[model samples]
Target: MTILSNNSQVTYSGTGRRKKSIARVKLTPGSGKLIINGLPGETYLQFSPNYLRISYSPLHILGLSNEYDIYIKTEGGGLTGQANAIRLGIARALCTINPENRTALKSEGFLTRDGRVKERKKYGLRKARKAPQYSKR
Candidate 1:
């Protein structure tokens, strides 16, 4: 089931994607705790400052960093992709809580989806754009 449809009066939810990663985020009233895949955010994201910053960008941008709890369930892709996906999901969930935030979030580009993905390799290519080696002999 999608996160948006699963939201209740007390919870706001959003779904986000980046590369091969997908994140479902839920926002609820509580201490400013963050959970990812059933683990604490700090533990799941490790000590990477970049991951923490990227994952919490949306909340920080809106000055709501310590207002609510963040719960994320993500799969696919690497750490960076998962972080960005969670950021987008949180931004969307915030918009659900207060539609007025939509303008600010959209203006900040958090509402825009990243469509970039790896291209498939061609039949005769080593990679998406890499050509096979030439043998002049």
Candidate 2:
């Protein structure tokens, strides 16, 4: 059976996390161009090109891509974090857009959110799990 039925269209959602920050993204199909919260990133360059390399959505969103279209809204993260989140969100949304993509996306590990974070410092130590230097007097 196909992952997505013919002409299937669904909303895509995903959460992105990066070093002490988190982001959420929502994606939807549009007319041959990406539109993000009504803002055109092409003129403003709201995000770095490294992040934009993820897909044609943002490029189209910024009116830079020749084909493919999407709209995205992201919140709760730094620039890099937001980009990653948006990437994952877009990947997931792609699955929603066409379930046939889910397997490939999942295999590429694009659907998983990075959950690593700084560990809490210990009360009696100089840092997390680090003990004070001892000097015998």
List TM-score per model, in order.
Answer: 0.91, 0.60
Q: Write the per-residue lDDT of candidate 1 for residues 1-137, one digit (tens) a residue.
A: 22333444377789999999999998887778999999999899987899999988888888998888988899999998999999899999999888899998999899998999999988988899999788999
Which ranges of candidate 2 are over 4 A from the true structure? 1-24, 31-38, 42-47, 55-68, 125-137
Model 1 residue pairs with clashes: none
Overall local distance difference test of candidate 1: 0.89
Best by lDDT: 1
Q: What is the lDDT for 65 in model 2?
A: 48
Instruction: Give the Cα lDDT of each candidate.
Output: 0.89, 0.57
User: Residue 34 error for model 1, in Å?
Assistant: 0.5
Error of 2 at 26 (Å): 3.7
Candidate number of the best TM-score: 1
